[model samples]
Target: MTARKEEAGPSGLASALVASGALRSDWLTTFNAVPRGMFVPDRIWPGIADGTRQNPVVDRVRDPVAWLRAVYSDIPLTTQWDDGSHSGDGLGQTPSSSSSQPHMVFSMLADLDVTDGNRVLEIGTGTGWNAGLLAHRLGGGNVVSIEFDPDVAEQAGENQRNAGLCPLVIVGDGRLGYAEGAPYDRVIATCSVGEVPRAWVAQTLAGGLIVAPWGTLYGGEAIVRLTVDGGTASGRFTRSSAFMRLRQQRPDLPRHDVYLKGREWPADGIGSTTTLSPAEVGGWLEQFAIGLQMPGAFWTVERYDDGTYTLWTYSTDTLSWASADHEPGADAFHVVQSGPRRLWDETEAAYAWWDGQGRPGFDRFGLTVDSDGERAWLDSPDHPVRCTDP
Candidate 1:
């Protein structure tokens, strides 16, 4: 390993996470064994930024430093696009694959309770970072990772080979899990699932643990940990994470014209009155509430010569949201208000509720999943059920 990567080893970051109570002492070897830099290419954004994702450009034969930093950093790197509509040959807006952030992967693994000799099956073979960690910890033969995108799968295979950590890397829809490797000690998904695939639960050995990111109707994402009981599995939200929306479940981009047409004023006591940017507020909703409330506003952030800012949210349902500079005020933006759902009201109310809760996140939300589906409660097992969605 290079000197720079050596400096970022599990010793420092692992110590920090342990001090913060995010990780334990025993898993340090997994961190050391898998040099994250080897999996990532050089010159990429550490996290998603701007109006889209942060791109990590790789030139295997050139710019080794850039590659090393991205590889070693605990951040995820986007790898694929449009679920094959775009090619992994280059980078673009659509991110179909990624090497998930190290801290997040570590956190998820800690939650999985992976022990020595554990037979593990991982979903989403993105950049193969998680698979590397698993293989390092539990011998190559004990690890199996599946990816849906064929090109991505091939690339990940190459990365795994380069890292000299080999496992059963397969290109297949993860929704089915790896039936041939059923009864796994642990099944973890690096990708997000709109719903807990029933096949995963059935395939897990009774008492085995399944960790996955579950998408909710409320707009937020939660890491759910389920332990198979009888034929059912039950667990709760361990944390909050955002993954590129699933291929089959990606929301249909609403009609721009239809949304614009509904931009109007108050009708039947329902109108847009808030001076908050709906985009910021809505994204916040995913973090604050269980995602039951979705911000119905949108905006284009503009900076003025006077150092002022302008933000707006327009919808075809006649409900428009706008905000300006200063402590959350907007300029002479537009508002067309009319909708059965009262988009602004729902958004504001959810925001208010989030504030009331003091902005709890994965630290507060607990999950319990079984054959019946999944439920989101608070931190304590006895806490009030917050979300029960499929």
Candidate 2:
């Protein structure tokens, strides 16, 4: 192991996570027992180390200090991008794969409530840290993990072997949920899924639990914990997390210029009757609501030096919208929004409804799976439409 990784092992990481209020005594024991450095590489992106714009490339094998900080810190250490075709070797636009930060992994595992005898299936093995953790908590034979990329799966398998974890790692689509070993007690996905796959619910035994990162086509990401009831499973948002987009459902990497061309405004014009910014509105709904309403609205938030902020969202299907914190009396941003869906508006409405319910959110929400389709709320299971809107 690199000296930097050596420094972060056990004590340093334990202290950092504990102080951050993200570590519990039992969980900390698990974190300490497993060597995180074994699952990560000896080099990583040192984001804005000087508290400026420069994100220097640091080598753990070479720079012990840099390695220790990167390894121990709660921030996610990105591993691959563009489905491993493009390396994080040098910083760029896309982030394809990664070893999820320690806190996120611990949080999800804690939500799973797995035990020694539980059989687990993990989607998107990535660096295999989670699978290893599962294997450690459960047993090597009790875990099965799948990855889409052949190279990534192979690498993850090696990482698991190196870490002395014996999870049955496979290279294939995770949507199928490793049916060869059916009736898993727990299923967890590290990658973000656009929808909960039917197979996941089908394969999980009655009363099993599935904890995954789910969202809509647009971009609201949240961690969902669904408990399988008979055949269906449902739960609420345990926390908020950002993960690499699922391989099959990833959006096209659109150029900024293409979206900006010939932008049109709604006849109602910029000074419309809207109270909240698009992002704030987007966050109001579950990611599913945003995705169903706005098929491809991509958003970017930028902060300016003059203590001003700008939020921009572009869509190919719906009317694009932008709002700035300090407009300086600029004409209201015109929105030529025209569609039956009215994506953003619908998202806002859903948020309003959810908030109206005292923000019942996901914790109160439950899942019910049956012969037809899976549903989010138990009371709504009898309704014609079962799936949650995104």
Q: Rate the local accuracy (lDDT) of all candidates.
A: 0.65, 0.68
Candidate 2 has an lDDT of 0.68
* Weakest lDDT window of 10 consecutive positions for candidate 2: 381-390
Q: Provide backbone clash counts, one per model.
A: 36, 15
lDDT of 2 by residue, 1-390 (tens): 645543545687777777876776667666766777788777666432212334556787778877777777777877765566655446655666777888788888888888779999999998888898888878899999999988878888888888777889988889888889988999999999767888898889888899998765566667888888776676666777778767887776455444445555333324433554444453534554444344456555567887555554555444444433434344443322333334445545655655565665444544444566544552243422222232
lDDT of 2 at 123: 92
Best by lDDT: 2
Q: Which stretches of model 1 miss by more than 4 angstroms?
A: 1-24, 41-45, 49-60, 84-91, 260-290, 293-336, 379-390
- Residue-pair clashes, model 1: 36
Cα distance off (Å), candidate 1, residue 10: 7.7
In candidate 2 the C-alpha lDDT for residue 68 amounts to: 72
In model 2, which regions exceed 4 Å deviation?
1-7, 19-21, 46-54, 253-273, 282-336, 339-390
